[model samples]
Every structure is written in C-alpha cells, then in structure tokens.
Target: MAANLFVIEAPGKRQALAQALRAAGVRDVLVLATIGHIGMNPQGFKPLAIDSEYRELAYRLKPDRERIAREIEDAARAAKHIYLASDDDQEGDVIARDVMRWCIPEEDKGKVLRVRLKSLAPSEVRAALAGAAPFEDASAARGDARRIVDRLIGSLSSDEGAVGRVQGSLLLELQSKTPVAGVMTYVAPAADGRGDWTAQLPVFAGAAVPDEIQAIAPLAVGASRQGTLANHVMAHDEILLSASLATERSLAEVSSALQGLYERGQMTYPRGKHCAVTPEAVRRITAIARASGAGFVPGLFTAVREPGGEHSHEAPNPMVIGLSLNRDLGLLPLDEQILVHVARRLIECGVPCEVQAPDPQQLRGLPAAAQGLAWRRRDAKGAVLWREPIKAGYRAWTSEQSLLHFMSKNDLGRPSTIVAHVSKFLNRDLVTQDFDLTKKGRDWSAHVGRLFGHQNLSKIIENYIEEHKKAPSLMVADMIEMCGLNNIPTDQQQDYEYEDFEISTGNFP
Candidate 1:
C-alpha cells in the first residue's frame, strides 16, 4: 500500500508536527512540505464583487499559474490520501483552499483534505490528522477580507502612520459595538538580551549588559521611585495591549504612567506579562466599568496574548517578564525605563485598577511642570526649538524619535504573527489600534518627518503639535474619529480640560 501523504507549508513546522504524530503511533503517514503556497491572489483594497449573494468575497489569486499546475500534478501523483496542512492562519487557509481547488474530487469532495493544527505538539498534530474539521471557508473568507483590507491599506503604505497595526481592521468592524473596542499589542525582545537571542537563561542575559544593571535593578529603580507617578497611578491607564503601545508610549511616558497605577489599588505588584488576570478580577472590573457609566460592556473578555502555559515563557507584560527580573538586567537604555512604565501601566489596567478618576480642580492642583530636559524639536528644515520644561506636569522635552519607528519602511511582525494578532482584533472588534497620538509622539514625529524630508510634497508642514493638547472638544472628537475610537471615558478632558496646573512655575520635578 502506498504511504499516505501529508503536505504542509513550512519544513520546520512539518518536521516538528510529523515527529510528534509519529510518536503518537501514526507510522504510515509521510509528511511532505511544499514550503508554501504556489498559488495566491494579488493583494488589494477593492473587494472582488461576489454574486451579491455574499457567497464569496472578491479577491484575485496570485500570478503563479504554472506553479499551481505543478503542485496539482504532484498532489495527484503522490499518496492516495492527500492532506493540505498549511499554517493555521488566513494566509495558510488561503493556501489550503487554493490547493484543494485543484486536487480534491469535485463530486465527493473527500479526495483532498484541509487540516488545521495549532501547534506541532504530538496531540495537536494527531488530532488534526485524525479527521476533524476541514478548512473553514469562513476562515478563508475572513482571510479574503483581510487581503482586501491589506490591499486597501497597502496604498496607505506598510501599515504605518496608523495606530494599532495589529488591530487595524478591528476599528472598522466594531464601529457600533458595546462600550469599548480597541487594539492592544504585546511586544517582546527577540530573545534573551545577550549572546544568542534564542538563549532563555536568565544569568547570561543579566551579565551581558554594559552597566551590569541586572534586570532586577530597573524594577528596583521603578519600585523605588514609584513617587514619580504619584496619583494618576491610582487612575486607570486605560489600554489593553502592549503591542500597540510601542508607538504611543515611550520609555519615559510608560514609567511616568505606571506611577499612577502604584497609587491605585488595582494592581497587587505593578508590572509583568503573565496574562495572569484571574476570573475574579475580570468579573469585578467588568462590573465596575458598567457602573462607572460606560455602557455597552461585554460579558467577559479574553486576555488574548497569553502564551504557553509553561511558567518559563518570558515577555514584557502586566504581571510577568518584569523589567527588573529580565530585560533591564541586561544593558538597556532610559527608553527601557519607559517600557518598564508601560509594563507597570499594563499590569495596573489589565484587570481593574482603582483610580480616583482625575478631577479637574485636583488635576489643576497637580503641578503642571513641563520643564528642562535635553531634547530637540526640529522643523523639516532642521530648525530646532529646544523645549525645556519650566513646570511640573508640564511636558519636559520634545523630540521626534517615534517617527523613526512609524514612518520607517518596515512591517513589524511576520505573516504568522500579523495574522494571529489581527485575527484577535477581528474576532472581538472592540479595539482600535493605538493610532491616536500622544502629545509627544505626534509632535516629535511630525517635526522630524518634515525636517528629514520624509513627507511627500502634498501639504504644507506646520508644527502645531500642542494644538492637539486641546480639551477633548471638537478637535479631540475629530482626532478620535480619524483614529477610529469609541467609548469616550469621562476623563478625556484632563489633558485639554486643565489650562494650567498648580505647580510653581519653573519647577523641574
């Protein structure tokens, strides 16, 4: 009898899954890999007009007809049972669906099978091949929607200048959903901070840094100076994902933001990425949110970024991967101080952080000390205005470092991550990407972009970044609309609502 043949996309993935399945007592299965799909549709924003029955999404397959023909011939000549086990995301779904079109029997529809597997572990691989569900057309359809969105978005160029790169589509799907629909990100260092990124040990990572300030030191610094955040730590930082924040919150702002959480009773110990929010906290926070007058709440939401149940997985988050414990131990930068703050803020808001809720009078009483720091703001022409913070609560300095990340020509994640993260965004459709600019990000990037001549010659360049700091009035509304956000919290006015704070003029801290 001919060996049953299974074809998957990636060689490594195929090998891993194959070994696991073999270990699970499947002996006759021959796992082969095409590496990837030979056939795919060219990407675009315009949807292929289905028959108006909504049966099919409008999309085009790729230009690789010859390759598709070769794949079909190979599939036909191989084992009697052909399985198309591609990556488990839309791109993979599309690949399987396309491959099936040629190899599967038109009448019985059983000759070819599309298998979905989550990971290469033995049980999952065995379960996947054991004949459960075929490829989901809905998954394929959603894939089509994504491709169309991408095509539309590509003109927007490389998913940049947009907030929530991962949650880009969600803002569209969840226009009228319940309370809040938004995107959040979960970012991690490529690896342990030292010699090899794949290295997972803590000791080497800590010693690799120049300062020898083990990750523990940074966390110590954060915990020690918790005074910086003061009261707002008690107020909610109000965001969901760490991934979307890279562009929005810098290292400084993140550290500054978490201080507010330390003041709030929501987090037990600030900072981590455990995805560890418990059932109790979720329930409690959801109720408080409903009572706080923000309606449209969902029953309970999933913390989507949780990874392997393995206690060893380390990444920056609300409650695990402490900068003190992991990242800062290696040599790092002040920017990491900001990331530390972000981790703390994420932890505080992950479940239900107790906040005093900024009161306008009290906010005014909080020092408005935007003062002396060594930073530069330049026009498109490199004309620089150094903004020295002269007051507390006043912004200390201005620079356009963020523009380097957002405006640069790189899409941050690979095909797999992009699909997974975006899928999460699509499923709930509650969140928008972190497209809305922080007062600093927008000012710095805009100035630096024009100064560096990165902008196309379409509009006149002007540096009015502070105008964005206006009350959550018409301008704020306009910004919210453009960024595609909902669930306007009451504290929206704290930034623009306060004209001047009570801090003595020229106060640095």
Candidate 2:
C-alpha cells in the first residue's frame, strides 16, 4: 500500500522531503500539498460559536485549498500511513494543525504521524520516519494564536482608525517595529572659501550628469568645472548618491563621470543584483581607467564583490589606484585625496573620517544659523576656507547604507525581512516614497491608524501572537477579543455591509 506525506504549505520543502524519504529507501511515499489553510472564520466577527463540543469554528476551504484537499484525500485512501511534514517556522506549525483537522480521521489516527525537521535531507527524512513523534498540537496551537489574533484584528477593528494591508500574502512577513528616536546635528563643516560645496554630491568613474545640474541654483556659479562637472554629476547620480560627502573631490563629479561612461556605453550598469563578477568586466574596465587615467586611485584593483543586500555589496565598477604621473599628473592634492577617500568609503558601511587642520573662523561659525546658508566663509579664516570642518553632509552612507538605511532605523520595520517586505509593498502600490510618503500613501496610513487605535497596532498584534504561542488555551479568548474590536477598511466594510449583501431582487409572481 502507498504511504502519504501531507504538507500544509511550502511546496519546495515538501518536494525535497519526499525525494529525501524515497532516497533513504522509504518506498510507497506520496507527498501532497495543502496550498495553505482550509479553515478560518467564515463570515462575521462571531467566529467562536461552538458546535457539538468539537468547537465547530466554521472554516470554508479556499478554492485552491479545495483542489489540494481532493488530491490529498485520494492519496490518503491509497496509503496505510500518513505524515504531516511542513516548514520549520511557526507558520508551518499552524499549517500542520490545519492538516490534522482536515485530512486525518479518528479511526486511522494511530497510522498518521507528525514529521518535525530543521532541514530537508535524506538522512533527516529517514530519522523522522523512524521516530514518527506525536504531533506537537501545542506548537501548532501557538501558530493558531497568531492566526487567530490576525483574524480578530482583521475582523473587528473599530471605525476610528484606518487599516493598512502591506504587500506579501502573510502579515508576519510585512509586520515590523521601528525605533522612535533619531540623532540630531549639533555641529558644522570647517569653512574654506575655496572648498567646493558640490563635495556633498558623490561620484563614480564612469557616471553621467546633465549640464543643467550646474544651473540648478546660485551654488552652481563657478562651481568646480561647472559645465563639465554638473554633466558629470547628472551622468553619475547613482555613484554620487552612493558616496560619502566627506571626501575631497566633488562626489558629484565622480558620480557624473561614471554615469557618462554608462550612457556612452563605456561601463556596465551600477544598479544590478549580480553576485558573480565577470573576469572580462574587471580587465576591460581596469585597462580603460589606467589608460584614460581617472580617480585618485589610478592603478587598478583586483575587483571583488560581496553577496546579496549586505552593507558592502560588490560594485560592477572596476577601480584603479595611483596614476603616478608625478611631474606630469602630480600627486593627488589634499582635496582630490579627500574625494578618493569618500569613494572608497562609500562602498563600505558607517562613517569615514580623517584629521586635518581646522580654519579658526570656520570653527567659530559652528554655533550659528549660518549652518544652512552657503558657507561663503562659514569657516573662512580670511580668504581660504578650511576644508575639513565636521560638515553635516561631509560624511555620508555608502553602498552598505542602502541595506540598513530605512525601516529598522526609522522604526518602520525589522531587519530580518524588512527589505523584501518594503520591496513587495512598493511593487503592490501600497507604499510610495520620494524622500518620504506620497499623499495617497499618507492617507492610507491615517486610515490604518484611525481604525487600529493610533497606538502601536503592529506591536499590539505582535505581542498578542507571542502571548498566544505560549498558551494555546488563550487563543479562542484572544481571538474573540481581537475580532470584537472593529477596524476593517472602510471600503471593504461598506462593500460587505449586511444591507448591501442582498438576495434575489426580482420575485416570481
């Protein structure tokens, strides 16, 4: 007779488990999927109605779920034994609980087993089958606590606050906590009349910039290499935005140059998700940098990139160091050296700094409103503006900052899965940003806050779920309490209104 393996969700892991069990010599193994949950509160806020002491909390199978159930039932009929194998997370635990409620029967209860796992491998699968432990119904109960709380919140939130649904089918992935505090600036940059203000902009070797950048405002007048440089910044906005402001050369210039290269087909795109660096990529770019001879580092690097969204992910750009033009090109000037420092540091995480002589008067300017205005002599000790005065925009986040910049730091979300969550929301049109939230997005936020009680609703849900995990018996009570509290979206509430939900309008006379 065939044996069945019923997994509530995670087709990938379930498939792997099936393969591993078979490889381990457990023949007659048939793996099946549930897609997700089959049972949940069917209609309204009242989900706790009891029925025949089985707690018939009504749950209707979703269309996809019904299909999965049919397949599993067919498999179960052929099998003498069954296994509930799901993921390692709490969500997986809840899925198992649902599986037990549905597929397994009381008469054949002893023939079924729960297979716990950390990873899916032949050895692990074999070990699980041999030890077929009783279902940790309590563990699944913890997940039920979470599911119940989510349902309660979704069903009963009051009309005073707005409700927001983030991207991702599962709320656990989208929910997060952010810090409520941030740092304040109490200082200013050293004033050097000659200090090019554009250093605030960043640079890359082959970046591009438009000529209009230099004409954005008065700051562009006689700006370093104005005509050529602004184009460079526009050309290299990516690199410029990516570099530290503390560096000597205008990050604008560097980034713009990099952009120009790309637009001109001289370089590859900087914004990409590739982990593997091409050998030709390193060689061709390096040779060009050495020949055309740009950047403070003119000699060529071995070129290495890190994986995925880490702080210092590898850039596709090949870099060169020390052009060594001595008499011809001359040593990298103090300003130039600073610019290079910013670029190198931009690729890594955190702040980069170096000690330099401070212009006295510029030091004096630190205590005033001159902070915002263009530092004509914000640090002027007569004519020359001292270049290194703890400037606000001087030091900046690098490639690494993009990984940790928003969400967690801003108390928007957590680190583990925040990035993907934000990306998903962006894709779903649920959230928008330009330096901050758009009007529609802000309106949505207001709606959610109004419905959810203006307090930390995300935290409230998180705590509720966590508490339920520890005490399964608390689930029904918690869910009941949660659902009784109204806060669904106004649109959904209106559309599903009892009055709107009508039966046959025309009667047969």
lDDT, each prediction: 0.34, 0.40
lDDT of 2 by residue, 1-509 (tens): 46655553545345455556667777776767675556654444433222321132444445457677767766766678777766444666777767776666656666667765423333334555666667767767656555454444444323332233221112222223221112222232223333333222332212332111221122212222111101111112234333423232343344444434333322333332223333333443344334433331212232333221212213334333332221211255433433343333222211112213333344343433332333222212221112234333223233223322333333333322344444445543433222233454455455555444444544455556655455653564654456344322212111132333233222100
lDDT, candidate 1, 105-169, per-residue tens: 45424556676654443434555666445554544543444433232222232222332322332
* Shift of residue 131 alpha carbon in model 2, Å: 5.1
| Superposed Cα RMSD, model 2 | 15.7
RMSD of each: 21.5, 15.7
* Consecutive 10-residue window with the lowest summed lDDT within model 2: 226-235
Largest lDDT belongs to which candidate? Answer: 2
Deviation in Å, model 2, residue 166 alpha carbon: 6.9
The estimated TM-scores of all candidates read 0.36, 0.44
